[model samples]
Target: MMKLFHSPTSPYVRKVMACVLLRGLQGKVELVPTSPMQNPGDLQAANPLGKIPCLVTEDGTAIYDSPVICEYLDGLGNAAPLFPAPGPARIASLTLQALADGIADAAVARQQGRAQQEEAGPTPRQAAFQERQLAAIRRGLAALEASPPAALAEIGAVAAACALGYLDLRLPELGWRATHPKLAAWLASVEASPALSRTLPPTA
Candidate 1:
């Protein structure tokens, strides 16, 4: 079985795990919990960047980053491909995935900002940085709401679900649902999937 380095609360890792379950390849892969912040040697050996969701193939080829890992898993089973083949649909899915991933990135930045404020009292600079991330998230959410995905069966939808899930998990104060009802509704439907439900980030 392939091995995956991941953290229970990582949205990126959640995306990959969701993909694995969606593809019916759960039994083919093993999850190894890891934290990049701690820089574990095993993670480093698998991925120099020490990132979670790194998949080590049977041939020992290590694939880092969620996009790559998810694609690798999508190919493992005869189930419908989460990532559409190269074409207009593929372009659309990849674009949506990028936007969703951007939201996740901004959310993480906001979380780090909170930590910085807690460690060393809130500062004008930290506030400014957070405002910027919030703005980015707002823009991303608006984009998704304007043109919702045709269906939540592609990589893009998977990514968007995890991104919104992370926001709900780590930054509820943002109140994204109030501003983007359409996106929220779509996310709610996607979250109903058994595969996605199984990969929900651990609380506390």
Candidate 2:
């Protein structure tokens, strides 16, 4: 069985879990709850960057990052490809996934900054860091609203939805849905997928 090193709270891990469900490969993959912050070395041994959602194959090869894992899982099942096979559709899906990943990354950074302030004393630098991260996230959401991907049944769509859901979970003060109604509606449609519905994150 493939061992997945993941944290329940990680949007990236949730994205891969959603892919596994979508591809009907849940039985073949074993979920291993891991905390990168508490067990950094263990995750680092699997992925040098110490990221969550690392997939250690039965053969012992480790795949880091959600996109690569999603692609590999998609190939394992008889279902339609999570990524388009060729041309513009493929490019658009990949681009949307990248945008979504960017938003998630920004949110993570902002959360980290907040953690730093709470752990120690609030510093001017920390506030600036959070502001910059939140700005990037808002910009990415706006861009996604402007050019939404047409293929709503692919891994890219799943990734984007997971990112938005994470934002709702972690940064409700941002008011993303109020500003981007179209993106919010698109996310609602995507959330209806059985794969996504099964992997919805628990409220924090």
On residues 15-129, what C-alpha lDDT tens digit does candidate 2 reach at each position?
9988888788889998888888786676788899888899999999999788998888877979788888989978988888998998999999988888889999888888888
Give TM per candidate. Answer: 0.96, 0.94
lDDT of each: 0.88, 0.85
User: What local lDDT score does residue 106 receive in model 2, on the 0 to 100 scale?
Assistant: 94
Positional deviation of residue 73's Cα in model 1 after best superposition, in angstroms:
1.4
- Give the Å shift of residue 129 in candidate 2: 1.1
Please give the clash total of every predicted structure, in order.
Answer: 0, 0
Which whole-number lDDT from 0 to 100 does residue 8 have in model 1? 77
lDDT of 1 by residue, 6-51 (tens): 7878889999988888888888888887878888999999898877
